[model samples]
Target: MKEISPKEVEHMLSDGADMNIIDVREAEEVAEGKIPGAVNIPLGLIEFRKQDLDRSKEYVLVCRSGGRSGRAAEYLEGQGYQVVNMTGGMLAWEGNTE
Candidate 1:
């Protein structure tokens, strides 16, 4: 799996890049805040929800910290999905959140 920094992700979003952002954090964590327009699919439920993701699209995985998203990215990559782990996750994200 590849890795992308928060700054790069933020810039890409602002530039209107065609990409999918998936937050691997749990509901409670996401309720506090999350990158704007990101879709939440907690790490624990990734396997069950894998079918919801499109293999043809590019995706960025995020979490409270980088750990969980890194694992998620690896799993998706193994399944032949184009995915990248957002480095530093929300802790390093400097972009707007909802």
Candidate 2:
């Protein structure tokens, strides 16, 4: 899986990039704040649950400080999904959130 900085992601969003961003962190961490519109599917749920995610689009995985999501990305890639990990995770996000 490839790594992408949060700042880079924010810029991409501003430029109207179409991306499928996923928050692989657990629900508890999501309370801290997440990139707006990111889908929440905890890392443990990635195997059976990844099917809920779209395969036709590109996906970016995120988690607290970048650990969990990196693991999720690797798993998704193995599942044949085009996945990228958000480097630094939400800790590095500098844009608006929900």
Candidate 3:
């Protein structure tokens, strides 16, 4: 799986890249805040919600830190999904959140 920095992801978003941002944090953690357009799926729910993702689209996985998202990225990659893991996760993200 590919690994990308939060700043790079932010730049891509600013440039209007058509990519999917999935946050693998739990509901409580997400309530604190999340990258503006991220879709919260949580690491535990990824397998069950795999079908909710589009195989043809590019995806970026994120979590509180890089660990969970890294695992998520690996799983999605194994499933033949085009995905990248955000290194350092939200802690490293400097972009706007909601």
User: Local distance difference test, per candidate?
Assistant: 0.93, 0.87, 0.93
**What order do you get sorting by lDDT, best first?**
3, 1, 2
lDDT of 3 at 14: 94
Output the lDDT of residue 66, model 1.
97
Q: Please provide, for model 3 over 14-53, each residue's C-alpha lDDT reduced to its tens digit, 9 standing for 90 to 100.
A: 9998768999999999999999889999899999999988
- Clashes, model 1: 0
- Write the residue-wise lDDT of candidate 2 on 1-98 in tens digits: 78899998999988998778999888988988888889898888889897787787789888988988888888889888888899998888889989
Measured with C-alpha atoms, the lDDT of residue 57 in candidate 3 is 92
Candidate 1, residues 1-54, lDDT tens digits: the string is 799999999998899987689999999999999998899999999999999988
| Full-model lDDT, candidate 3 | 0.93
Candidate 1: residue 71 lDDT (0-100):
96
Q: What's model 2's overall lDDT?
A: 0.87
- How displaced is residue 94 in candidate 3, in Å? 1.1
Q: In model 1, what lDDT does residue 93 have?
A: 85
> Which residue pairs come into collision in candidate 1?
none
TM-score of each: 0.96, 0.93, 0.96
